[model samples]
Target: MVEPVADQVLRAIDQVRERYYRLIVIVGPAGSGKTSALQAVSALTSAPMINVNLELSRRLLNLTERQRAIHLPRILGDIVQETAAELVLLDNIELLFDVHLHVDPLRLLQRLARNRTVVATWNGTVGPNGLTYAVPGHPEYRRYPTGDLVIVEAKP
Candidate 1:
């Protein structure tokens, strides 16, 4: 029997908490229900959900490299820090893929993980190879190391 996607995500969340890990990336192609799974997990866990809207984050994205270097971390850092829950649900993280911005999202998430677990929805695919970012051949594609990451592939 096939396990429900939410169950799979919940299992991964459990592992992250049990192992004291930081990040659980739910990867899948668009229309694969990644966001829905995140919502369901949030309901079950009662974790505060933060949705990173690209349009809203544009202000930070537009900052000069020098300014962003100093403030971007502070901005994203605040979201993770403000949530007291042990596990935070992060959705619409595609904003971090903007090549124009100098945000090292995965690194930021990992840093936050030191305090709590982060379950984020990633618009991509995870396979035997690795996580491939949204855009094909994009610079962010296949850039993250998967060894420490707990990746749950969202099934349609």
Candidate 2:
């Protein structure tokens, strides 16, 4: 039987466990099966998988720029603790692409990965330019660094 590509990605993730490269960003176009990959991996893993929906996270709390920078990690940390999960799958991360939000999500996720492995779905394509969160000229146009990030491209 042929293993699905997500299994391959999961194997890579598992291989990197306990290593310095703990955070992975799966970048792909819409409907490219990134979320499905995460779900499948979550189901088969021994460690609990905490799926953090950025949309719900945004609605559940309101914070100032300073407060968000300080508290977002704490809030996510609480969930990780409650779920007893060493691996976290972040979905709907495009919500953070809103330009009005002052928090740098890449930095925040990077910080969180220091404590636990994070695999997030990015709603864009990764290329030579980097991880383009938004098209150029858009208010949210920002290319976060790909350095130290284990990038996986999800196939449809």
Candidate 3:
């Protein structure tokens, strides 16, 4: 069965479709239904959604941490080709930020968002622009940035 998309996530997807390279961040306290909301959106849009768990795949890979950044796009590319989900979702983005990296995960996300739409679930905000990043250390993350990322948390 398809999940119900929250009003905010629905609105975010609508906004992203209107604007290219849109980066939107979804932030909330733990167990606050962040992942649920993302799932709902994915179902609502019928876009293949991938919940990229930060703790599991990004860190456990056997390759060097630096290579993760370089490798991530390839992995994502495979997934995109396999699934062909127009909208991509990255869940639990905290691990990507906290881990020591050879490549910037933010760049990868930005690069992916360049053409297709990406809805990422982050722990907090990222930089001031472009990347749809979570606020650093805010523990409330949801971003869709198109060169200038300005997040306004909605009441879900």
* Cα lDDT tens digits for candidate 1, 15-128: 776565568888888888888888888888898888876533765667776776567667777767777777888888876766656677788767777778888888877766
Off by over 4 Å in 1: 18-20, 54-65
Per-residue CA lDDT of candidate 2, range 6-125, in tens? 776687787668776477888888898888888887787755554566543653477776665566556765765576577777777765565555667787677767767878888787
User: What order do candidates take by lDDT, descending?
Assistant: 1, 2, 3
Candidate 1 residue-wise lDDT at 135: 57
The 0-to-1 C-alpha lDDT of every candidate, in the order given, reads: 0.76, 0.72, 0.58
Tens-digit per-residue lDDT, 90-120, candidate 3 = 6766555544544455566667777677766
TM-score for predicted model 3 compared with the true structure: 0.66
Best lDDT among the predictions, by candidate number: 1
Error of 1 at 134 (Å): 3.3
Question: Predicted candidate 2: what Cα RMSD to the true structure?
Answer: 2.9
Ranking by TM-score: 1, 2, 3
Over 4 Å off in model 2, which ranges?
A: 1-3, 46-51, 54-59, 62-70
